[model samples]
Target chain A: MSTRFSPILICGAATLFSACESSTTTGGGVSDAQSSDAQSSDAQASDTQASDSGDGSSDGDDGGLQDASAEDVVDGDDVYAAEDALPSDDVPVVAEDVQARTDIEFPSDVDEDSVTDTESPDITETDVPGVDAGGPDVDFADVDPGDVDPGDVDPGDVVPGDFDPGDDVQTTKGPQLGEPCDLSIQTWCGDEAVPTLSCEYIEAEWVWTEYNENGLPCFCHPASSPGPAICAVPGFVGIDQSGRDRQAPSLRALRRAARLV
Target chain B: MADALTIDFDRSGIIDPVFAHFAIPVPTLDVPPLSGVVRDAAVRIWVDRARSEYVGVMIVRKLHGLLVDLNAPMDLQELALRMLLDEQRHANLCSAVVGALGGDSGVTFDVPELQQPRSAATLESQLIEMLVGTYACGEVVAHTLLRHVVKALPKSGFRLVLQSIAKDEVLHARFGPTLLASIRAGEQASWIDCPGDAVISALYSAQCRWMLGRDVVDARDVRLFEDDEQARAMCSVGVSEPRAFKAAYMAAVERVRRHARSR
Candidate 1:
């Protein structure tokens, strides 16, 4: 199943070049391609505070959390490692599992293209958990649906990966983490060249495009296609989906393979 | 050879396909030699971490089941399934780390019975709450701690293993927000109010206890091993002390808060 080079890969390639051209300063100081401030500051501060902080400290405040430079241990740069030398699209997929998937024969009546999540039939079952263990903390009854403010956990509160390029976009008033999106091909977030795919509903009807500011991609459930889906890009995170080709990009978002240069 | 899960399973004769997949090659895993107290402590710390990752298999399996059975959403089920694999991969890496640290990689791994919180609630409510705890709050805890640990260690095989785990964790940590965003405006609001923001506070507390200890009344203030000396020592060799964990936690908490308030 050799697909054409996905634009997401192209985008990653472009970003990779840009990231390299501008990755000269391994110091704590911000670089040109530093996408998100929160993540950069967060990474810098964590590295600093962890080294400086002993157990004597009571709280993890920004009090002693100074932005320490990386020049001390700047012997090697992981930026390239993060880009090329790290894992390929050959992520994790059991060979037997892929073989089993290849053997599946959909019903004769099933129209693969026309089918959406709601109409799609439930496929064979994989390993699942039986709810034998018992527990409870908050009763849903206490959380009055009608009275509760629309604001719960703000999607903005989502702490993006330490080096997520998306955070740079997300910080600029992007959709909250759980905001609704659609599968229609015509729409691009603010940027025409999106990073990867995102979700409309939580179930399986998904496509992959760039993770633009418009659609951040929602979580998944009842996925239309289910199996071990892993993609292996030449220079980027493996970007393939079991069902929709675009799904690889969405999963890539889940991987958020940050550039740890 | 010292992996706890594989220790009991015979590798001879017809083997399972899943186990075969564990043979995939990872890059930059050259384990640096360790000695003295640092070696002793690194072994101890990594062994405990491996066991924790071992338990993670159960946790991910349970979470995957919850997502599928509840029919929460399409992509989430897929995400959980991928997460299932990621958890196993992390366990594998951690076991490898334990071996490199001079300890037997085969620690006492336990498969504690899975506890389904909000057992009395509707499947919808349970799914929402669990997502908050498991991905949002819980992964946040894991990511923060791991990131802190990764920062403390130099470039070594141990660091590479932890860094790989961190890559997956960072994504999982962001799942909470994405899930919550979907829930807020979805159709289920008619029957269920929201996924419950308090889910973060409640689930985070529960996670702190699970990771640190049972007596951790407040995650914000709890010290690792209940001793500062042990905590500081652990921080040096890539095993964060309790205070270090708290620092990352606070940072994670603030990230979520800032994003929330950004609007």
Candidate 2:
């Protein structure tokens, strides 16, 4: 959040058009073009921040403009790279970054219709694990659910924690990332402290066995499952069954906790 | 079917019960259904899960609605249609899935009641026009939560479906800013001002902390923002730049605030 860099919605715009190629290659081209784009993006970043800065130049001082390092200038997406900040050994190696760092110049003039607007003509191909398998069955064994620590076990699983109908509850299953969840197939795991009862169970016992047949791992909370999986976590239902049922309040509380609200 | 409880509404109805029924847990795995005190715990857990999904659906629907329909330069209109189709399918799929889980289908849109009828020619009068504060705040929360869901879910048959959905969203998040920038460009020179940014910032701040709590295990562990391929594909989308995404959100909020204040 603190990084100071130009803000442009890169999506194939500058990349496909080759608009800035001339600016970066010519003498002082890189700085001029970058500085100009920086100014444009900065102005758009926020009216408030731009106003407060008095002069937008205050932001460029943060080291975004330092000579390019091993990191390739990822054109469209404005990646946040600390100026002169040495690349870490662990981050995944990018093909673009292989080149040695240099003080490359960018184009000074803005050509709206330039070919650089859209980078490469075709979308780049990248590899995804299990995407190619294309098999009907999922490779569950390939997934590493990671080490589950017992210390952080939630008590709500064992005993519904202090239930407050009006209290805002956070749901673990909200559309947090970007996709919709098929609630029917979503697998539920009770809190580690109390692992019992789930939507899957209902399917297995009273409903359909297809849910259990899928054999998905249970990750009640987020930040656990990295692989493609639909995790269902059991929630607490308030005892009040009348008008303004406790379920509504309890559900609201979970959504609040998850920040889905 | 004998014990089924049905409730019908003449006007609009709240979706809490629909969500709660889905939240109720029945248990999975090879373990036998727990009885006595354990049974109590299990039931509680089940309800909570149902509740979470219920909340998640609402957020997803609203966020999707905002992102897919913004006016833009490129194939946004086409993209918007595609997104709407996808969302409508999603809504149908969600309804079917929830119904299968014993949850009732209680969702209904009353936009006609909320606003005066606007013809296709008067699209500008639409009440649901993407509001900057709502879009920024909802999506801030949505992006973070979806990321967490993606990380939390593992590879399984069900997960495959989720993965497909998540993959689609990665693209959706990419445009959040491009659309905002377009709006900002138009508003900067216009007579009508944009929205105040502070409200959007406040919403984003809340969403950020909420995301941290949901995704982060300890202070040391930073959840990978994007998986290897997701990161690459997202990076390629030029619009997927998080920095620009942030800027777009900020600018949008400012425009909304300004516009609202002027109104």
Candidate 3:
């Protein structure tokens, strides 16, 4: 599970952290009102990601923040735009890549312990959108921290980065039937090598009718019944010896006939 | 006058049979010859017993196939072969009983077709279906119904014969779960994914067909011994009352479900 960090995520986190610091220094400390405003900014940044990818724009340095205000902008729209630009021939962004990227980038701020206690809670509460957007790599270390709200990015709207097609392909084989059975059609043809028996889908079900080399129904049993329809009398000594008509005689009538009543 | 039909066990190779131990002196009925009602009831029992024995033959054949296909142990195959012999004796005994009642066990139905491998996705699935259909549901219900019958019958030659059959059936009933357990343990997978609902439905279908004698006796022509005592007696001899059979069948299904879950 390789994690590919988007430059947009780092720049956005740095810009959001800078804004928190500036707001705290100017306002004396982070307040309830300030936290609420930050959440609103996060929501706007998410909207920016959504619109950039939705409209098929080009992946550039801008984080699709043209429509969003400075206080509520995040980077990463270009990543999505570049992902969208790929000729529609390739496989869609794999879910694992997006998840891995989001996991690595979103928790970085928390791991560095850069924000104050009041600021940390607000940043931690921010919702980062999980997106897979492909774009040229940009250096976050060289970029200036601008006023942007990382929390505003919706994980869902984030464009996924490039994914290796072969990584997730599973090679294990599922269990095979003894015979070549088509589950959808409900027909079974025995292995070609042996070809001892074959069944046909008849009467809305499958039955093992004997088959020869030519695949014709053969007489398997002594009784001449082919399908379930052929009715034959069961061998019963009582019925054979009685030679009496089939009739339901009442117990009372039987007792009377036997002189027991 | 109808001469009493005697069963020669020596010819059947069931020397000193278990039934002989419980045998009571055969009673001489001074009553007139068997009436139509008695004859009908006796014939029904005889037919049911015959069908059950025939099914035993099919089970043995299926078991042999399973042994080859699954590489099942020799013990299981041997037990199945033994059951075949028991079923044969049971069929003959039933025929003799029918004759004793002054009726002949005639050719009423054809030898049952070897059960088509049930509709399933895999060979394992087919084996599970057959195992449950025949043993878990079929034999278990048979044993339950037969136990009730054995209890209702008075100590007599008829009861002795039934008891003998029931004894073998009880052992046959255990084979299904035992084999299933072995397969599950060996294969390292639950081969029979029998849901509670499916188990109930399968049991209900098999038991209802058995109770009504759907394949053996024409539904319209089948006789019900309306009288309470008569119906109970009929059930004792394997002609089950529909309601009683349903209750017993449901109980057996529940037991199977519990056993499955426990494993």
**Candidate achieving the largest lDDT:** 1
Task: Write model 1 residue lDDT over A88-199, tens digit each, in one string.
Answer: 2212233433422211112232222221111000001110111111232222222222222212322222222242335543322233344443222212222222223332
Give me the runs in candidate 2 sitting further than 4 Å from their true place: A1-261, B1-81, B99-133, B186-193, B196-263
Ranking by lDDT: 1, 3, 2
Q: What are the clash counts of all predictions, listed in order? A: 42, 78, 32
Residue B230's lDDT within candidate 1 is: 49
Error of 3 at A240 (Å): 21
lDDT by residue (tens digit), candidate 2, A1-261: 100000111111222114322211211222222122111111111111111121111111110111222221222221222222221221112234312211111222222122111000000111000011111332222222122222343222322323333422212211121122222223333222111122222322422123232233322121111111222110111111111122122222333444553
1 against 3, candidate with superior TM-score: 1
Per-residue lDDT, model 3, residue A9, is 24
Query: TM-score of the candidate numbered 2?
Result: 0.28
Candidate 2 local Cα displacement, residue B72, angstroms: 7.0
Mark the 10 consecutive residues where model 3 chain A has the least summed lDDT.
Answer: A116-125
* Residue A170, candidate 2: alpha-carbon lDDT: 16
lDDT agreement with native, every candidate: 0.35, 0.24, 0.33
A16-115, model 3: which lDDT tens digit per residue?
Answer: 2243232112112212211211111011111111222221121111111122221211122112111111112111222432321211111212222221
**What C-alpha lDDT, on a 0 to 100 scale, does residue B30 get in candidate 1?**
40
Best candidate, TM-score: 1
